[model samples]
Target: MSARLGPGRTARTVIGVVIGGLFAIPIIAMVEFTLRDGDGHSLAHWAALFDPENARQYAPIWLGLGNSLVLAVVAIGIVLLLLAPTMILITLRFPRLRRAFEFVVLLPISIPAIVLVVGLAPIYLVIGRTFGTGIWSLAFAYGITVLPYAYRAIQGSIDATDVRTLAEAARSLGAGWGAVLTRVLAPNLRPGLLAAALISVAVVLGEFTIASLLGRQNLQTALVVVSKQDTYAAIIVSLLALVFAFVLLVVIRLAGRTQGSAPRTARRAATAPSARAESPSDPSDPSRKGNNT
Candidate 1:
């Protein structure tokens, strides 16, 4: 006889299925629309994605894509370096500060990007006007704006890690704090780091409000440039962004699975041999279960 799922689990499963369909349906429709030809289903849009004329018309597409990638990588790296240590420190040394830190970290979400852009414009204008380099300026903006998402992702990871115990164990083993953090905590926090990095990338790639408001020539700006002239290409750009987001989801899922499975495997490896050694008779082993306990 099959075991029955509990009511709560059944309800959750139903809700999950509904939500999944709600998201998937629109994506499927977009793909269908993008692929449909003027005459019939065709590869024109997909082909146009690689065309030289398309690039010329959408000059910023290439530039914006490159800028976006750079922003994502740098922003994600900065976030991990800054927030990981901060989270660990807060959780380990000053647990009481967590609420305050969280409140401050989450302030970005409460403030509109438009407001942030307006506030930062004067400062960035001076730096850019003086230095004649908006490259680092834009990157810094992207990185700062990504803080809330990145912080939450990493903070959740740090919280789940029981970093205090790990750090103590490492110290007992004569490892320095740096060594402990790099080896023990970072490895365990990989999933959260992956999620945070991808989120930062997604945010940077799709961020139009701040970049446009700041008059920065970024990916979002490029999208806007083409969007006014060619709605079709704009839709294609949107499709490509969706594809990137889907790829990010896959990466996060795989990372989560790898991280989640390690403890189970380690436990089995550590316990199975001990169980065998402790058994006076063979019965406890599955191979000899019929013989004895």
Candidate 2:
């Protein structure tokens, strides 16, 4: 079996390398492009980004980045707290409404971003008047935009997990609904939640159309604004943002893996002591009886 699978494994590795190379080439090209200067390649453009003298030039990018971060946090909180709990409720209680719920959650994606902006523009105008035109208000639109991806991630986890059984068991133990949802169901859903959150952040950061049309600045919009004048610096910042997102993903993946393994490790520890205790007290064992005698 090992011999048979060797060729297949090699093919998969080859395919993965080719796919990865396709992505890495553009990034490599971008880096090389950013380093070009008057005489030779230099970090001059990159260094200029942090120069106190030129801070004003980069201020818009920084402000946009800060706004994007705020949007990410609020959007993530909205999705996880609101969408996650709602999913669990619908799954456990309103199972028949699954299709309708999915239709509503996923409707945003079918509409073009520009079209969504058209509808959102007026709503945000009202919101701005009421809430005073903060960039954070953009998060509501982001939350709606991210629902499709977030819902898909979380719904898959719910399906794979025995949420009904888990909730019932918790309730039988005298836990309230809130306790059952948070303490019992949420942990089982962490992988999905993390994945959904990552997707949300990525979508929000890369977003341009809605933010542009809405007259709000985000990371992508800032990059576009900077690119017109200092293309090299904008490219550098873009690369950095991509690296940040990639690193965040890897860190979350590691954290999720660690969290996943913890329960199995704990279960093993719990069982091991019992197995050892039971072995010696097995009266049917002649060796044990002889030793006691």
Candidate 3:
């Protein structure tokens, strides 16, 4: 006989379905809107986005996509490079400052994007004056925006692992600090790093406030520009972006789950042979008889 779900499980399922439906309705509406035209349902708006013939018309979108891709890469790289080493060092050497580090990283979440833009304006102006208005310049601000997310992800991974023991083991094996970080710690933190990167990419892709206020033409800014002329196509693009972000989030969650299972599996495998070896010997068995003799 199959076991029935308890009231708690049933309630949770109901709540989850409700939440899913609530979130899904907007996407459904957007999809319907994208498919609908004056006469009937159509896909002209979606097709136009990808049609080579309309490249000239969609130049802003293509340019913005390219700019956003660059920004995402640069921003993710900056976040990982900056945070990984710092977090590792803090975990290894400055354990007392961990709380302070957490506070600093999370501080950005409290600061509104508009306020951040206001503060970054002068600094960006100086940067633009020195380096010109390259889109990559936005990566610095994007990195800052994603710091809280990246920090939490990385910190969680660090917390899950025995960093001190791992470092000491690596060191005893003649691994230097660089080798310890790059070869030992980094591999273990792959899930967190991937999660942090995906979050940063999503944040950069959807970011409008900072990029728009800074006069940078990112994906969202370009979508806004397109919306002025062709609202339907803009909606289609927005729906597509939403779907892409959803996929990334799903992947990050799966990665985290996979990472969580790995340590348990490894530990079980490592102990299984030893456990068998230590098991009580059967009295009638040859090994047991020989030991008794």
Please, what is the whole-model Cα lDDT of each candidate in the order they appear? 0.69, 0.76, 0.76
lDDT of 3 by residue, 144-228 (tens): 8777667656655666688899999999999998899889998987777777788788878888889999999999999999899
Candidate 2 TM-score, C-alpha based: 0.80
Query: Counting only residues 3 or more apart in sequence or on different chains, how many pairs clash (N, Cα, C under 3 Å) in candidate 3?
Result: 0
- Evaluated with TM-score, which candidate comes out highest? 3
Look at candidate 2 and give me any clashing residue pairs: none
- Tell me how candidate 3 scores on lDDT: 0.76
Q: Which ten residues in a row have the lowest lDDT in candidate 3?
A: 284-293
lDDT string for model 1 (1-293, tens) is 23454457678799989999898987787778778887788878778868887678767787888877777777877777887788889988999898778667666655677788888889888878788765556777777677666665565456556789989999999999889889988888776777778767777787777677777777778877877977667778788887987787566555655555444322221122122222332232222111000
Ranking by TM-score: 3, 2, 1
lDDT of 2 by residue, 52-140 (tens): 89999998899999999999999999999899999998999999998778678767756667888889999999999999989998999
Scanning candidate 1 in windows of ten residues, the lowest lDDT window is 284-293
Reference-based lDDT, residue 82, model 2? 97
Q: Quote the positional error of residue 224 for candidate 2 in Å.
A: 1.3
Superior by lDDT: candidate 1 or candidate 3: 3
Q: How accurate is candidate 2 locally (lDDT)?
A: 0.76
Model 3: runs farther than 4 Å from truth?
Answer: 1-19, 260-293
